[model samples]
Target: MKIGLFGGSFNPVHNGHIKIAEFAYKTLGLDKIYFIPTAISPFKKKNQVAADNDRINMLNLALENFNYNSEVSLFEIKRGGVSYTFETIRYFKKKFPNDELFFIMGSDLLPKFHKWEYVEEMTQSCQFVVYKRSKNINKINAKKYGIKIMNNPIFDESSTKVRQGQLALVDVKVNNYIGNNFLYAKEIIHSLLTAKRAKHCVAAAEFAVLLAKSIKYDAKKAYYAGLFHDICKELDENESRAFISQFVENAYDRKLFPNYKLHQLAGALWFKHIYMNDDEEIYNAIKIHTSLALELSTLDKILYIADKICDGRAFAGVQKLRQLALENFDECFKQVVQRNIDYNLAKNITFSDEQNEINNKWSK
Candidate 1:
């Protein structure tokens, strides 16, 4: 039997992957194709990849929609650590010693083929086939290496495009899954904020979900609130003040209009203004994420605590605060608030009247 091994990050499988699988199945005359998702690609950053289950589930969903004799393989994902092609080929060869195995890839990777670990050994175990990835790629490269290049029709879809909010490039079910679960929250955040800031936002979103789950609050809402809490953090003082002046009714209150706190108000309004999302809970959570309010809601506390204790944040007692958040939320909330207050006092940071009011309330 002839079997094909199609391996990739498949961060969130899209239509392009299904197209390649279908083309390979017919062109290669393979009995079955195994879609192998790498746990960690040596070529890609660790944080850039989606969770293992999410990637696997998306691949399954995409494969289900396409008419093909293919299945997702957890071999590489289960193995963990940086996935090497040679290691994967060796395992598959042993598992199906009598079967002719083909290692499938794209034209784009042809140039880097020589750099892959154990390239010579892998070739001896399995036949290498390259599928044309795009119209712009030259065929000379594949021919020069004497590798079988499949002239599959250009689908011109990529996981990067899909992550950047191009839902149409993916299967319908996969598209719905990404939307419902907020799978590419980092991509969306990264597009707006700096890389460091984007990482923090994504971490906060993840931490918020954990806190929400502990309290039986709405996890999805908490995720959105945390992910976008600092959306306006990079805004200039003038732009931020403009947003606050227009959207905030009490902008005239000089005591509350601290420069540092401008983004909170601006982000809340900008989210509503841009997305037209009238979710008062999410908006309020973003508004008060920097400055805790008296008698906070569950969602509010979750976002605040998440922003303070998320993985990207580095400070004393962060680990303890994270543990306390999972075990005892009220105590964690108080400590986080107190820590913020203490930091402000130590730095001699000017306290806005709003901060003073919140401090007084929390004090009592």
Candidate 2:
């Protein structure tokens, strides 16, 4: 009988992790695989990154989709120290003495064999299986290490790349902590935003999705943020004003708020007021898209730019702004800010602190 030992931080085990185990199952003819997330990695600080519980949660989510490739063992994470692979291998050997052990890893990490404790003895303890990762060719100095390489599981991926992605098909990245934690609103949230605003929201969602895809931000989360950016825009002036009054108290009515900016604040308030769905991410996007939103999220940046450049907005130079959004976000933002500033100046309209704060923030 042969069982595989696949262990790592599993910290948010993503699609890549699942792929490796899946490939290993077929290529190496393994009976079962265990996904062990490190509690305290010897290589790095535990607190400096997501906590074990968070990673565990993402693992739960990954397993929900993968079902077979993921299972949780508190062994190393509960032990709370540097997780040396030798210690894990020894324990698994004791548990399944009759089963053949195949330790799966990438070809690159094989060189650090000497660094692992009792390296000489560990090699004889289990059959090591190295997989070619990335574009790196299958170059296994197996005879020297008394190991073999699995050509089938040679996936071009890593945990680093998974975390950097906005979305993954079958990744361990959706562990218990981040498991389905994305914010969402069901019905009214959609009803509240205007057709024009809804179009912008969808565009912003797509824009944020594209950016997150580029940088590996969470597409699920970014998409929700985009769809809800203007969720309160459809609220009547009185209802919208009432919602804003709770946060921006100055005996301020909706009329006091600027048309260009009232929607942002209103959207944030309405989500909590109506849906009992309070979200900091959604609030941030809604509050910041008007004037010159501050400290923008990937989703916020998309909505802000989309509002300025959406096809429905016939404002001056919108075509150019949309074109610029593809290449230069900052420049596009500056142009929007400058246009608003000039518009206010020409109309002799009074500015609010929100407007002033945004204008100052974007200038930086």
* Model 2 alpha-carbon drift over 4 Å, by segment: 44-47, 67-70, 137-141, 153-156, 169-364
Tell me how many residue pairs clash in candidate 1.
0
For each candidate, what is the lDDT? 0.83, 0.65
- lDDT tens readout by residue for model 2, 34-102: 778876666655334456777777667676765454456777887777888888888888988888988
RMSD of each candidate?
8.2, 15.0
Q: Count the backbone clashes (under 3 Å) in each candidate.
A: 0, 25
Q: Candidate 2's error at 217, in angstroms?
A: 28
At residue 237, candidate 1 shows an lDDT of 82
